[model samples]
Target chain A: MDDLRGGCTLELGSMTSALKAQKILGTAAIPATVVKTSASGGGRGCRYGLRFSCSQMANVRMILANENIRVREAEWKDGS
Target chain B: MEGRELTYLDNAATTFPKPRRVIERMNDLMQNSGGNPGRSSHVLAIKASETVFECREELSDFFGAAGPEQVCFSLNATSSLNFCIKGLLHRGDHVLISDMEHNAVLRPVYRLWRDGVIDYSVFPTFVLEDDGRKTKIIHGILSKLRRNTRMIICSGASNLCSMTMPLAEIGELCRREGILFVVDGAQCAGHIPISLEEMKIDALCIPSHKGLLGPQGCGAAILGKGVMPKTLIEGGNGINSLEADTSGELPERYEAGTLPTPAIAGLCEGVRTVRALGIERIAEHERELFRRALIGLSQIEGVKVYCPHHEGSVLLFNKDGIDSEELCLALSERGICTRGGYHCSALGHKTLGTTNGGALRVSFGVYNSSYDVDKLCEALREI
Candidate 1:
């Protein structure tokens, strides 16, 4: 697993949307990887999100929005 | 007989020997992507969600739904019927149903009528001539239509008798009269080809576990344009969490809580298999089996077979002086499986004139062969 520190993670509502976002971002040449949402980060049940470089974060969000995929939230992890 | 291979003839209840790919896909999903679909974002969750989406797309294409989003998954055909019937009907609304409807459609309507929520009437059973069955049935249905009629709910094919309903004609009638047409496709979805748009069906409820050759615990309802049913269950749809009401999206509005992702995955593969095999080919095979069974059973003395003239793969009959339940037990002892009794379709029994004693139902599927039919006839003869 690549260290996603300093990258922006786009939390999606469902796994289907997350995969769609990943596919769209990949097609757009924006590198992104789907990872499990942290248990404590949300609540119960499995969740997924896409992690991408902070430089392409705005572009990724815009593309997902264009596709009508809902983004639950986005969190930026700070490097320790 | 105890050691002989068991012959399964109760395909109407649920299909056995599901396509190999369906089983494999379900197992793979369970092993690799057993996550709650549509509830979160993660690798496994995304895979699970994609599986569900693929299923919806396959079902939408197969059923001629407007889009994948218009297909909503449920527990079974009964659940889908409940969602459609209970969601769409209001107080004093009139519904027209066929005399051959299974309990899945009849019971819900009866309950609603009992509670003063809706009213419904059963179409009279018309005597079928060689070439006028469809016309007579259509006339019977049209005559029962009242001014307050809001919708028409019927089965694609009768589960008890294998008699297929005239869905296209009924759909046209509903369209011209501005009445909604809802079809319960529990016995016919994968066995017969249906074009939801071409047929003008407003809503179609299907069970994947039956002719679709999928595992149990998963079904779907396809909604046409401008057909919106009230939400049957209110819970988390993973959208609009801040608000109190459920999401108003096509499927999300109807689907609440975690979906059966693994089952949906299996259903996708099942639909794929059906497409590959082609529904026409499957129907031809089952028709042949039904023909053979009818011939074999009709030859036996004291056996009165009902619904022998239908084109579908179901056959209903009873032996003289033999109770249906006792006949079923005898067949079971001889390593044969056949469904006997009311078959959860009291109205169908009445339509077939078998209300005094429920008939024995032998339904053929893709896996059935002439050998199974021969074995069944032999068992019947012995009894």
Candidate 2:
């Protein structure tokens, strides 16, 4: 796996929405992965989030915006 | 009898000899595109997701839904009705349904009533009527409306009698009264034209296998503007994976788990075939067969035909001395397939006053022919 500290995560409302967003991003050629919500992030339990390389964070956001998929929140972890 | 050609007249239960294209499309999906939709970024998965979305769009357009998002897939019309009825009604809410509804609608509402979650009433359906039947039925429904009545659920056509309900008028009544209207289109979706926008229907539950010519295990609920039922099932929708509850979005809010992608592919072709052949033409052909069967059965001695004037492709009747089951079995020995007894619509039998003896139902489809009708009439005459 890539360094966890060098990636960005997007919290979504449900798994279906996340999967739909993932498909749209994949069709647009943006690499993304759906994963469990971070436990310590005050995130809603049993939710999912999409993680991508920190370097492509802006591009991913722009693509999701174009598709009109709402993002509940975004978080970036910094490398030590 | 062993080598005789089979005559299938149980279309109301589920259509047979599905459109050629529907069969081919389902086979193609099973063989070439078996990826789990919306589960990953692989090429097969992406292609599967696209196919599912395209199917949704096709269904939405065919039903005149607000958009593809307004369409949600389910196992069958019963599941769709459960989602709509349970999601929309609350404790103490009053619901109105017609007496002709199948068990799909009746059972769910009854379960809710039994649990004291809600209460419902069955309104009357009109028989062979003169000029004022529509007006009388509408007035009867309006008279029963109470301050607590929140929704009206009805079938587009009677599966037992084959009588087409005045849905557009009923929908108008619901609109003016500000009551939510839902329709069970199990017997009419592919045989009739339904425009959700024009009909002002809040929700429509349909089975793909019966009228849409698709395989079993596929159905859809089309939501109209400003209508949102509570999610029936909560699970992975492949979106908002961080939430503990289901999504509040259009389809994602209702649809859960892995969809039946192969059935949906078949549904797409089914709708396309219906559109290409024209629903009116298919309906007309079935009506012709229904008319011939009705005339022939009515002339037979000791045969009592019900709903003789119903314009749909179904006919219900019984012989004076023969039990409906025995009659059906005799017909079966002659290679004819018909459904006897209550047909899972006990309420419909009650309405038709056939509760005591039940009736044999012979339903037609686009594939049925004059020869099939003639064969059925000949068998009835002999028995």
Candidates, DockQ: 0.19, 0.19
Cand 2, B chain, TM: 0.97
Q: B1-383 in candidate 2: lDDT tens per residue?
A: 44236898999999887988999988888899898776665667766766777787888899988767778899999999999999999998999999888999999999999999988998888764535767888988988999989999999988887788788899999999889999999998998899898898999999989888888999999889778888879897655457777754678667779899999899889899889989999999988998898888878999888877777788898899898989999999989999998899978998888998799999998888999999999998888
Name the weakest run of 10 consecutive residues (lDDT summed) in model 2 chain B.
Answer: B125-134
For residue A29, model 2's alpha carbon misses the true position, in angstroms, by 16
Which segments of model 2 are wrong by more than 4 Å? Answer: A1-80, B1-4, B128-130
Error of 1 at B270 (Å): 1.2
Estimate the overall C-alpha local distance difference test score of candidate 2: 0.83
In candidate 1 the C-alpha lDDT for residue B157 amounts to: 86
Tell me how far the alpha carbon of residue B97 in candidate 2 is from the true structure, in angstroms, after superposition.
Answer: 0.6
- lDDT value, candidate 1, whole model: 0.84
Q: Rate residue B120 of model 1 by lDDT.
A: 91
Deviation from native of the Cα of residue B166 in model 2, angstroms: 1.5
